[model samples]
Target: MRDKAKGDGTVKPKVYIAEPVPTFVENYLSEHCDYEKWEQNEKVPRDVLLEKIQDKDGLLNFGSAINEELLEAAPNLKVVSNISVGYDNFDLQAMAKHNVIGTNTPYVLDDTVADLVFALMLSAGRRVCELDSYVKNGEWNAEIGKEHFGLDVHHSTIGIIGMGRIGEAVAKRAKFGFDMDVLYYNRRRKEEAEQKFDATYCDLQTLLKQSDFIVLLTPLTDETYHLIGEKEFSFMKETAIFINASRGKTVDEEALIDALTEKKIFAAGIDTFTQEPIQKDNPLLSLQNVVTLPHIGSATLKTRQQMAMTAAENLVAALQGKTPPNIVRG
Candidate 1:
């Protein structure tokens, strides 16, 4: 580690970037402060983070948990800026207790993630992966039978669990492109969404039972952990398609497994998982009706550049004794 004091005779704010981001973001950090960065391909091990953070005033983090244990190890830490929209990994209360601020990149990746959610919905409903496998497995010698038929997406009803920015984007696509009816359930009604897309607002149970497609887009919070469980699955129509582009813990994995195995719903397209890089033996992988993806909702090159830039700006602002633009409150 270099000396904490700079040539200007002032202590340079030491910043530790947990993961490698865009090159432009790295350049910005290097110009502004004394910064240490982890390699792009792998996360910094927890032990290294604990040791390095002791002298850091700011942290640029991606996907690592920020809690009391981490905060206790970093007495000088003043801010944590996450390069993603979701901040469920942050323990806000712990940060507040330590007088540290939290910030996240939002609005930049909404359209990119919305596009992925719509793609997942279409693929799951149409059995795109299954049939591709069927052809590659040499089962295409004869015309496919009625048993291989998939469901229609256009003119169907889609119930969105959260009416946030990305949810509104998905609703717009469903309404404009697919001519589908949009139903949404949120704690508070989205009047503009209803006015813009002719979307209907309803209770959770009503949305679950009536829609032909169900998409979960709620953020992860105490109130929303395992929001969809066994009873929630029972509410869906037997032919409905389920899509989750939100946090994995929002849905109970075991219940989802049972729902798919028993044919409670037609199929599910999942982007997030309770455990990332989902376990090898996870039952969802063995199910024919489930389409699973690594959590790549915000993985587009352009959007990621924007997110990294935003996070860098946030970290710089906080370390300079200014309030971060996208600060997250406890």
Candidate 2:
């Protein structure tokens, strides 16, 4: 509350948005604060994030890395708002140590991401991309035998790596939409698991071995970083479809490429990458079994609008000497 007025009593506080929010959020933002948005999809460089936010009380960031090194440049920063559900890009320990509040947009993206998870599962299960190419290349009439065949989802087994809000939504959809067996692997076993969708809890190794489709839904943490390595891939069934909609660093890309190239796994689908914009010479680019996306898990028009507005509200509230709606820390 130290720097509230922007030269006039009615003028709003200054809020720096590392990402450009949709038009829907502008009105809400104008109500409480004036915002500076980055015009492009590029991440704000660390020095720029610090320099621009040095005097600002709050910031609305999307995938901007706000580590201790970066935060040192912002002594006036009161709150950091992330438009994403995953805050791995931010350094929570540093923020907490510095007494800066951090918030994330979570519930809004849950369903959207769950939907994406199922979409990847279905695309892999049916060989959608491979066959689409075949048809486009006028090879549909050819003798595409069992080698090009796919699996049936109904009565099949599904394994989810994380059983959080998104995971639960995906489980419910799989249980009802395909009548599939749902097995979830998480740090802790949830109770609604059995009550809601009859989801069973199993160790990572067993889940990988049993699932016809393995979906990754966990956030990236030091402990979970590269949690899926070569050894983990070795435990999977050759026919198991691996779908990663979670943070890309959670998986070891080298092992994943080896698995796909060696036919260790049936197919793979990825909506995120260890590096964003996926480098021009990334190794996974050439794989026919992999389906890559530009991180569109929460890209629905309505969901994105809601997420932007929520993130704006969080910054406004926190900087106005109030608690944000979705505070990330305890």
Candidate 3:
């Protein structure tokens, strides 16, 4: 259904929201555009989104692929606003070919994601999830001994693979909260991070060998796909704890499974996976040393709401033919 015209008979821009958003964000979008939304909490089905986007001038979603097929289906589409910081789902070349602008919510979730990284680090290092299950299953009847002990995070060396805003947030926690020595590897050295967080910039191999905990926070790109595989794992210390809060494809799933199976690394905390809703038979699930999450890195209510609002603002700005604050350039 089309929205009623304004006082001057000017119709609002048409938009499709493929994911449910906060009421305030809906109200904000309503003020700027005529929108149809997928009301359910679940993601909009691809066919439904394609159909709904047929006449839309803007789209807002999280992790939906804005590829050739979708773009072809939406000849009127001018913008796609992603509610998450990562835009790997975007087919930048296709979007460009279709003359569509893309934007993402960044900075808002930096601290939130950094917190999850630390949670994963601590959970994997201390075997918190494993121990919790052991106690719940009545396996803790006997007094615990050294076998129940776990690695100490305080004063340990933490190597961060990405030195973006979220990585800096993690570094702050490592330095102030745990007094950890921070080492980092990035495409380009961040001098500010080095001085502020007392982080030492090193190559990937050096960081892998020296750090007690290695955290991967890099974005997924052609260059980063399977960046950490068997060869990279071989460089890590046997006592090292690996953490991935970035995209799943950034590390090789098979390689990670082998590393854990062979005890090449002591433990791992995985958030994003190569496949969402990870398959039942995936070997990662069977490993006691691995702590897996359903990719709730920026899932806090406040952060999600903020992201929704930011995305709404971006969609509105782009449709209005103004430059969006966070325009994503390939």
lDDT of 2: 0.87
True-vs-predicted CA distance for residue 229, candidate 2, Å: 1.1
Model 3 misplaced regions, further than 4 Å: none
| Decoy 2 TM-score against native | 0.94
Which lDDT tens digits does candidate 2 get at residues 1-330?
344565556546677888877876877886778667677767777777777887777889888787887678788788889888988877888998888899999899888898888888888879898889989998888688998898787799999999999999999999999899999999998987768999999999999999999999898888899989899999999988999998999999999999999999989999989888899898788887888888999999889888988888888889788988899864
TM-score of each: 0.97, 0.94, 0.99
Q: Which candidate is the best by lDDT?
A: 3
Give the runs in model 2 whose Cα sits over 4 Å from its true position. Answer: 1-11, 45-47
By TM-score, who's the top model here?
3
* Candidates 1 and 3 compared by TM-score, better number: 3
* Position 159, candidate 3: lDDT: 97
User: What is the total number of backbone clashes in candidate 3?
Assistant: 0
Task: Point out the higher-scoring one by TM-score: 1 or 2.
Answer: 1
- Which wins on lDDT, candidate 1 or candidate 2? 1
Cα deviation of 200, candidate 2, in Å: 0.9
* Residue 234 local lDDT, model 1: 100
